[model samples]
Target: MSRTTKLATIASASAAAALALAVTATPALAWTAGNFTATLNGTMTIDAGVSASCTSSTLKGTIASDGTLSITSATVDGCGVTVTPKALPWSGKLDNGVATINGFAMDAIGCTYGGNLTGGFTGTDLPVTATFANQTVNRTSGLFCPASATITAKYDFAAS
Candidate 1:
């Protein structure tokens, strides 16, 4: 074969091998799109002084293959204090063992609080556990509202 033709053939083969390697090196997602429900494992703390041992809380959302969490609705029930989620749809992400909820706004106890919540998440199988310890939320309104609040809660998520 001609020297130029042999070089062209080698280049084509190297390019094909690199493409294959890239495709194989891509990582698989930990979670997928599905109907998921999260339950509070323990008490949910609001701010610094108020602690709400809510009986039940509901989280409705779907996780995309790209780790994006699209929360359609959420409810915190049985806290005696009315807890209302401000934004209809909340956006979050789960990646590298960390879970983050962006723009999480809520109204409770005649006060408004909104911020991002970031915490660790575990479990590759079913019933993933997300623990948010001392996640800070800033008071958006209400004179009596605490300037900052630390929230600690553990939530278990499972496909429903």
Candidate 2:
């Protein structure tokens, strides 16, 4: 074969190999009741900027046929401060790649409460931690935090 033909063949082969690698390197995602960890990150606007993070492991949850993850119950105890309201309900849509929850609850920031954890997700068995942005929350007499604040959240599902 001529040098030009050899170069073309090499280019085609390299292209094919690259394509194969791309397809094969794709990750596998699974959203189910497996070894998972939910992490909370960011700050709580109170008397001071309180750092917060809540991590839970091996939470029992369910995945619908459409890839909707229904986490029955999970506890996240890292509110930068000590308080009673620790755990919060968590739900998500694996198919749509969205983190969600139902009802109002106290959040990770010590006393100040009223924040919902929500973020985007991906396909595959808890490949990466999903981060939900901080939400606006109102204060109550219960936590002693009179002013409202915002909180961000991050969650990771343990591989199946």
Clash counts per candidate, in order, are 0, 9
How would you encode candidate 1's per-residue C-alpha lDDT over 56-156 as one tens digit per residue?
67777887766678788788878778889887688887787888888888888778888899999997644688888889889888777778777777788
User: Which is the leading candidate under TM-score?
Assistant: 1
Error of 1 at 109 (Å): 1.9
RMSD of each: 3.4, 7.8
Off by over 4 Å in 1: 1-26
* lDDT, model 1: 0.80
For candidate 1, what is the TM-score? Answer: 0.78
* Cα lDDT tens digits for candidate 2, 1-160: 9999999999999999999999989565444444344443332222224544443323445655445665555544444455344344445555456666534355443453554556677655455556556665666434555476565555565444
lDDT for each of the candidates?
0.80, 0.53
True-vs-predicted CA distance for residue 21, candidate 2, Å = 24
Residue pairs whose backbone atoms clash in candidate 2: 28-124, 29-124, 29-125, 30-124, 30-125, 35-158, 36-158, 79-108, 134-151
